[model samples]
Target: MSQAAYIRDMMSDPASDLATGPSEVSSFYSNLNVLLTGGNGFLGRLLIERILRSCSGVNTLFLLLRAKKGKSSEDRFEELFDDVIFDRLKREKPGFAQKVRLIEGDVGQIGLGLAPEQRELLRATNVVIHGAATVRFDETLRTATNINVRGTKEMLRLAKEMPNLKAFVHISTAYSNCVREFIDEKFYPPPIDSDKLLNLVEILDDAPLQHLTPVLLGKYPNTYAFSKAVAEDVIRRNDHRLPVCVVRPSIVIATSKEPVAGWINNVYGATGIVVGAAVGLLRTLHCDPDMIADLIPADYVINNVIVAAWDLAEARNSNINNADSSKNPEIDEPPIYNVVSSCQKPITWGKFMQQIEDFGLQIPSMLCIWYYCFKLNKYEWVHKMYAIFLHLLPALIVDSVARIVGREPMLWKAYKKIHKFSAVISYFATQQWRFNNNGVLRLSAKLSPADQNQFELNMDKFSWSEYNYHFIRGLRVYIVKDPLHTGPKAVVRYARLRLAHYTLISVLCGIIFWLLWTLVRFMGI
Candidate 1:
């Protein structure tokens, strides 16, 4: 069959025998008590909301939270409700707050550092979704590993004790093995043994460990990726009797389609590119415009997680009677779903950039760019040279001006920090990695049409133009949370600023070039 026919068949509603009935949703829900670590975070928040909305039969959602000074878990939960992210949930389910129970806990400590009551709640839960981890690209290894690797181990330990546990879904990154050119739905052990890295961090002080991070992570681009890879390894090694699923999503960006279009709450991933471009701070980025960006929406990832949990539970239950065989399936053979876009259909980075630019122009007359240029200057060596120059020159100049003017240089510091972050991420920007998603395809093949629509990440159905509009809105409202940028006033201000800056830079470069040419002529060349 042609790939199109195959996909259509795969997406077609399953036969009644294969379909999950209402009772299944109820069973998934009543048996569906969930322990969600980092439930307040961007992806976590979306996942929680999605489950609550779509899986209304869900009995309870135990949100693991750390107790803050002078504030109770109840207070934290209340604050979360106040945010607009939960507004839709409140409207849809008036009493939905009752289903959410915040368990006082911290993931970085043993047993999730839960209290006796919280521990009891966790033990009684049927599913555990581990989504808590540091996403900062330049985070310290000590900090990243603590929450990413150690926290995962602690969660697994907790899951192992749950008598009625069905599925343990660990949220990981598609870039977990980014050092490799081709990634498949398979476990690639961490560059360093997880235990060894944990032990080394424990022995070394923060300063020493920070210095050694480069050596420790080696070819891994950043602490986030390195630590997540280790965490996945830990999960694979410690699978002991629990059905687990590893979800590796690539560069999760704004929502392509969901509860709301272009719904993005975090500024970490490709949202940074949109924000930088919209504000004109990023005039030139050293990236292969033609390469696939491999971005999946946050909601799409959450949907996959839910479906994976259901499928894993059903599959495990089916194999329960066959568990005693000498040839039991590989313990490490737990499904590793590459929740990425490269396989379904590829979207080029250049097209994405163009869409954003077009979206930016549609804001208003005041926000329109007089003229803009995107010169495709590709050089084998100059990309790195430009990266270094762009990263440092702005900060150096800004800092120098600040000192001369007797003013604090906040922009320079922000620039320096972002530059460091870009240095780590630029490697991926400059190259593309192919992920073999045969597993994702196989998983999709088994899903009912209703389930497939609910859990879809088909890039072939993605509309970049519409996505870019939401992308810009999501960046402004959700990521930046800048009221000024949401309306026309901000658009006017941005346009004036862009024109001023462009003129200044153009004049300066023109004068410098003219002076150099005159000098060459004076030298009698």
Candidate 2:
């Protein structure tokens, strides 16, 4: 039976063992002083919004943010709240903004770049959610290691120092163990020792390190996954018996349901794919159509992260009360939850693409350069042929036209960058992995019906078909900055583009046929 059906049956039966009392989750955060890194990031921002809105009794949320592009941490925090995602938060909890406090720090720096007083202040933190990391697949090995590997070690070190640390939730990617076909709720042996690899990056110069990256990465596909795998090992080695758990989410996209439906703040990972295809920029993708998409919504991930912190802390408390140190105490490793969709609610790439095309074209973007059309190739050679004809040829012609008109000739350059990016992500797209999400189910089952409703992470309950409709609409509003009010005009414009696209194709075919006929007649064979 599906997890949703099982949960529904369990809830309906009064004799069932599952708890139906007031939520322990929100109560766990009562008077809880939490320190959260990556509070300025996409998921981090959602975390802050959800915690403040859902767990009303929680004390303060200390956001660890570093100043970037000359903006002070305080300035950045103010601007962060200006996003439309926070609009509903402002209405529901008028005073939610007051709960957040910013601490200037960089995860890449020594001791988190904190002053002595700032470090002392964090000693009183009850919960720590380490969500910060560079999500870029093509990031430099040095940078990826610093932020993902070394940064994790530093966070663990800091968490250990906290006198009141109850739970430390580390946000990781489900693809961290992508080299393996089947992944369980446990740590795989990392490609290299965390400390040893850190030392290597520290000693080596950039160019040589870049050259050595492929060799160092070994079976891992990219720096992001490699560093995250190593970072998990860092936790395994240095957690120091803290209440820590890892939450690995796969291809996080827009919010399924929450403060707002289909709300997305960034165009990373799958969001980029949807947006690129919707805008008619991305024409060809090299991927297995049958491979599972493995997309978990952002709200689901946020809910799981919050629940993981509570669940881990509760487990720690229970373990303390039980106190069985004699029974292989060293075997008590941190729990890992693979927050993915495929286990409970699976959708294939072909279905994913068809749904996007069906729903997305209905509300096409005004920013679209061509009619919304894309092709997926399973074979690399076939994909290359498609790329040359469908992608590069058009791009070359457009760029040549622009150069003649003295308009900077950018289409070819843009396609080059787009192709490189597509190549980088094709690794994940072409492959499928079996992620064991039994831990996630157990965690949800442990939640009271009240908590489960408020902070829902059950993937079986999420409808990807409906979500894709809103996904495109959200892309228009948030990413494209085209609101629903303008969608009608955009739709009309799209119809014209669609007509022109087919017309051009027909004319080109006719010209080719005529040329062939003339050559045959001239040859007189």
Give the winner by TM-score.
Answer: 2
Q: Can you write out model 2's per-residue Cα lDDT over 1-525, one digit (the tens) per residue?
A: 332232232221222212455667988998999999998888998998889877867888999999889999889988989976676567667997677878889898768899899988889899999999998988999999999998899998898889889899999999999999999988889999999999998899999999999999898988999999999998887648777889999999988766666778888877888888888889888889999999988889999999999988887777677768436342377889999999988999899999999988777777888987788888988989888866787787778888899889887888888888889878989998998998899988998887887778777767878888777777777788775666678889989998988986686577669988999999995
TM-score: model 1 vs. ground truth: 0.86
Instruction: Report the poorest 10 consecutive residues by lDDT, candidate 1.
Output: 3-12
Question: Lowest-lDDT window of 10 residues in candidate 2?
Answer: 9-18
TM-scores for every predicted model: 0.86, 0.93
Q: Candidate 2 regions off by >4 Å?
A: 1-21, 325-331, 510-525
Indicate the residue-level lDDT of 14 in model 1. 24
Cα lDDT computed for each candidate against the true fold: 0.73, 0.84
